[model samples]
Target: MTEPTQDSFPVTPTNKIRVAKRANYDRDTLFAILDEGLIAQVGFVLDDKPIVLPMAYGRIDDQIYIHGAKAARMLKKLKEGLPVCLNVTLVDGLVLGRAAFHHTMNFRSANIHGTARLVEDEKEKYDALVAITDHLAPGRWDETRETTKKEINATTVIAVTIEQAASKIRGGMPIDDEEDYDLDFWAGVVPISTSFGPAIDDARLKAGIPVADSIRKLTSRR
Candidate 1:
């Protein structure tokens, strides 16, 4: 693929997509996929072996933030500036074809390449935490109790600047062989979606404490 313009991340060997037709280099496309995703698969090398872990992440501009316990192995290794690759995917549907070989899925996914660095600035760390919390449920940070110094101290946050990224998207019906088109078999897409269920209050909550507005708003949207 050719190098993309300024509006998109430049195409590089590390971030190139083999299926050029499905590749998208636009910043909007990449960020859209990232923003809608609830989990990210982070890949890195540890002890000369490859490791991939699912993590909760938040995006701020061109960077992604991931946090965990201070002593977590992945956080410790990534904070040392090791190369990392993060991926988020949302399955939109299941594509069923007449032939078994043509069965596939409709999905949107973003893959990012960068190096993670420990967040040292106090304000930045706090903001990153808020972004993460809101990513899970909008406006959740403001609706909850403030984080204590000890809680903040025990958590470790790392920022990964998006150096290179690409998004791949597939939608619509399945493609089958010309001969299979006339076969007596079903072929179509089964749409898939994610929705939020009614909120359940904590068992230990005090009497008369209703659901927070953030939680109500989030569930209502779905």
Candidate 2:
């Protein structure tokens, strides 16, 4: 039990990382992993069964927001203030090793434990939607059409204030036995990455309309 630094979240028993070497509790490290990820897997118990669903999310400081249809089962259950776990992972590469048992993937992942509650404030809900839209593509919310009141009424948004979080990162080459090095089996890392392709236009899109600057900039960087 090492104590967490002031900048890191406290390492409670539920959030403690088993492999201390791979554990990262620094605020920057945890936030970076979460921000870079596109999808979060939310886990919770429902009807005595564990359910995990992939969702798009937004982060506002320590709070993470997730939304769905108002009648969706996952959202319905989470809004009851039940405990939940959220996980986001970005795979960097495939770590190939001489021995099958040593093969692994290079990745960065963040896990959060918290209780979710329904967002009742109108302004906060609107801001959270903007954050979620922009998280998909920076500045996307502003470039798109305004959200109608009816649409907002049909959506259910829940906010989870991160109570405990930890990140685990694995990188570089795989670790193989000393004797396996001379076995002549090829071993190396196969790099992997996610990139955006050329933007496609909608079939019904007006001919005079052009791609938005946000999309142009995002695709250019990728």
Candidate 3:
């Protein structure tokens, strides 16, 4: 077997953790959490007010790509080289404790801070589109029809370099007071996961066309 490639993220003021111990600067850990998540919450300032909106994204190495309609307000603002805080999180489970105040969640999350740049080169734009597609549905990009120039021109893609990023994870059972451990309340972890269900055929699918093998593998894993 080949050895896994490793990369490390740099610590910066924006990504430094107060708790210290829960912070991770390892690239592998950050990438793993990012790959498992589909949506990213991008925070940026608009007219001196901070805003955060969830959007779909794809990652290639240390760069993350996000796209939207050409006229999207957020994308337009991001293209101006504004500071961005992109965050992705995966909720693994809910930790129930005897005391409501001790209840918490088991999660893996990454916070990436950088400036957003517009992707303009044709080749890179096409590759970014493919990455986004493959990230959402692995292997489906090749099975789909080719992208038209008009379609590509109408969409705007922004690339955010991972200049400063960090990962934080919390797992296992909840921490409760020693006296609360003997309480009559039930306490444990309730696991949570996103799973693919049975594939649904498109209404317009040709009768002779069968389910794609890539989709079969995707659903099977779930």
Number of the top candidate by lDDT? 1
Q: Find the 10 residues in a row with the least total lDDT in model 3.
A: 1-10
Clashing pairs in 1: none
Question: lDDT value for candidate 2?
Answer: 0.91
Instruction: Score each candidate by Cα lDDT.
Output: 0.91, 0.91, 0.88
Models, CA RMSD each: 1.3, 1.3, 3.9
**What are the per-residue Cα lDDT tens digits for candidate 1 across 40-139?**
9999998899999999999999989999999897788886588899999999999999999999999999999998888999999999999999999888
RMSD of 3: 3.9
Tell me the TM-score of model 3. 0.93
Can you write out model 2's per-residue Cα lDDT over 1-222, one digit (the tens) per residue? 457677898888888889988888888888888888999999998888999999999989889999999989778788667999999999999999999999999999999999998998999999999988998888999988889999999999999889889999899999999999999899999999999869998999999999888899888897
TM-score of each: 0.96, 0.96, 0.93
TM-score of 2: 0.96
Off by over 4 Å in 3: 1-6
